[model samples]
Target: MTSKNNPKAFPLNLPEGDAELLLDELQTRLREGRRLFAEVGQILAEIESRGVRDLYGYNSIAAFYEHVARVPRAEAQRVTGRALALNSRRARDGTTIDPVAPLTGESASTGALAEAGIDRIVTVMKRLPDHLDADERLEAEKGLVELAGVARPRDVTMAGTDLLARHDPDGKPKDDPEPKRQRSEFWLRQKRTGRWDMRGNLDPETGARLNALLVPRAYPAPGEVADDRAPAERRGDAFAEIVDLAEAGPDIPAPRQTAERVTEEPQPAQPSEEPASRPKPTQMPPQGRQSPYRGSGEGVQESAATERSRNVAHLRPPRWWARLSRPRSGNAAQPHKPLTA
Candidate 1:
């Protein structure tokens, strides 16, 4: 009986020798599949170049492959990409030279590399700078091919990465600062209960600045020598202090100016056959003498003292109320009159 790890164990229903034979056959088939995959890429590229899609009434080669060959859109793109990168063979004299992709395509045809290994190597090559001279690319490809012969796909990927880093220590195809800015964000969302959830991924510089400002405040105050606050509690307090300090800062912005309403020119009032008439306000009669103890409006008469007692008698009288209580000019000795509506 063969151990579970043995190749013979794969074809469980077969004897050891037969199972071993089947395993060998499967390995052979896998190699052939990879080689055929590479060839398919070449065919796909030719189809694209010839505008075969127009003849087939398909929008794109990928779409065609999606329907006809059942290949996914993404996988089709990958296959075509590999084809262009690996199958091209041309010299300055227009004569065909050896195909490129020494690591992936060449090795795949020879049954020395699997699809995963090929993919890894291809991915590494793709990430390399387009400005790389032919010689540099060839050397890199050669190194990866040699490594792939004995290493797993993951190891090949790592090896390729190391090679790339060594070749371009600063990292290739130099990135713009814009994408980093785009990746950074801060979010604050209000929950149904009126509380907020604050979350953010900040740039290194901003994060460092915030950390520097808050870290000191997060520690117990000098006066509270035996503080027992948890780290989170301390941090929360520190954050509150930071917010207060920010509020106190002079950099607080003035409120934004509202957009001015766009006023259209008023249309000239069309001359009317009859001019609009204005209504005159009714003239009010001069009040007869008002009693000092009674309010101006219609109501039961109450002495100023009595009114005050009903309200805030202990409070000093308002200036206007005091003036009203004092005898008016020319009415010093007038008898009090009952109020009327």
Candidate 2:
């Protein structure tokens, strides 16, 4: 009776057929998932090996990200950093770790690709201090290998390297274009990147001085106004404005003209008659009133002679051959001694 009263309820378990079916399905799913994961791991590793060589040219973690891995340049950078950290750990302890294994969802952990990309970028930064910024260098290393997993890192780096090589410190490219001997301007195009470059042939000092003057004109001083004058008129006005600025600019002190003292010969006075319509001038410009540049125009010949002296000063024979180069100047200081027998 007690068994009959208990028997109204069945055992709280699945029917055997359904239980077996559920177990089979779970086992199948698990096996498939493992297979998929392992497959991904192997593929990523294959990509990384070749990719590293491609972008890095021979061997590099950055290439691994970009080439064999097929990670986009940006994402590859983020992943490369993680790979670097792992490699560093492997390096510190005598352990060898594979970068792609974790990145491809093969290992117990995933998403390390981002970290790997970033770490690789940091390592690359150390290598290319001259060219790349911190973030950009890291990006190059990090993304190269990962990008290779999907596509070819060679393509990515080829494009990137070619483009990057053209930049200078000012973010403009340092131009090494073919000389424009005929024309003043010339352009150079990089075959790999298809970038164009420009060059000019100004001497270094001249270029710097010209830049100093032109930079201000390009970015004019405050209180300057633009005029709708023709190009020639504008240029003339600009010259005049600059002259005025030199004469009385608040920022710069005006330079005084240097005077040359004159050695003069007294000349007999020659008088000229003033014509009927002529008027006397009240004032004259600095040059007309008391000239500093010309002096008295008296010792002009002497000045010319002094310049000649300076010119010949550069020529001299060795002291042992003294008599060979000496020139006779008929002055008491340079008195002629008799030629030695």
Candidate 3:
């Protein structure tokens, strides 16, 4: 069998054509290919119905297709699976069982939807809640099939997802009466090198709280240099800051104060048996001779010296009377004149 636009049928020196004509031919060929693929799926479904094991000595239709079609195992399995999903099944009694997504199957058979778009539609149909009635499932499938006709496969998938959400808003049913228990674990260890290692397996609630606290602190520091720290390092630094803040809080207790004890009492001061020696008086300079210690000033140094002598004279006991009372040794001691500067 050969196609009208088969490359093998054309000459090597075929003439070039207008760009628009070339594009039109390409689109036509692509549509023909899609139709042929749909036909292939139908044939595979018929082969499965007849019993592949008896016909080809293979355990499964996918295995038989892989060997006969010279295709990869995964690809063969995908095609066989899609074929089974889009085709109706016969019960033991020969009663017809409709395909999961009958509308989607119909669209796929006509080559109006791509295989991926058909798969998306079938998935949405299968995921619809069992509580939903047949009519609701049919309506959802119909909507997705229509969306798949005009949109790309990805857009079809999105539409199918939305359809499933609208039909089954609660998601999977919870049969158990008791709520699930949330579990969390944390471990911390200090290495010999003085660095700490921390690990945690937090439940949803605790993880959310930790994430909220760390996200703000983990942001790169604002400066000319970009922050080059790894994410784990940033989080570690943030945790250390949190510890410091907690330690400095007012709730932390103050350290205890200790008092020193005295071992013995102090003794009272006692007078010495011998009196303290008195300081000797300084000798005065001779009245006629100028003192060598004097500065350039004529009378300033003399006046200062005189003031010192006067102060010393007041301190001296009245020696003139004592001298008179004592006997005159060599000559009668002249009445001692009062000391003068």
**Tens-digit lDDT string for candidate 1 (1-341):** 85677444444354556767788878778778877776777777567666654568787767777777887888876666666666654443556544447546666656677667777888888777777888998889888888887888889989988987877777745556564334667876656564456789988889999999879867764442566677776776667556544533445443332332123333455468866542222233222222122124323322332343333322322232333355767998994442221
lDDT tens digits by residue: candidate 3, 209-303: 88888787667756576777777767766665454444434454433222311322434444687573433445544322222321356246445
Q: Which scores greater on lDDT, model 1 or model 2? A: 1
lDDT of 3: 0.68
Each prediction's TM-score versus the true structure? 0.45, 0.23, 0.45
Best by lDDT: 3
In TM-score terms, candidate 3 sits at 0.45
Worst 10 residues of 3 by lDDT: 255-264
Each candidate's clash count: 0, 54, 0
Error of 3 at 109 (Å): 2.2
Candidate 3: count of backbone clashes, pairs at least 3 residues apart or interchain: 0
**Consecutive 10-residue window with the lowest summed lDDT within model 2:** 284-293
Instruction: Give Cα-based local distance difference scores for all models.
Output: 0.63, 0.42, 0.68
**Which rank order by lDDT, best down to worst?**
3, 1, 2
Off by over 4 Å in 1: 1-20, 89-103, 173-341
How many clashing residue pairs, candidate 1? 0
Count backbone clashes in candidate 2. 54
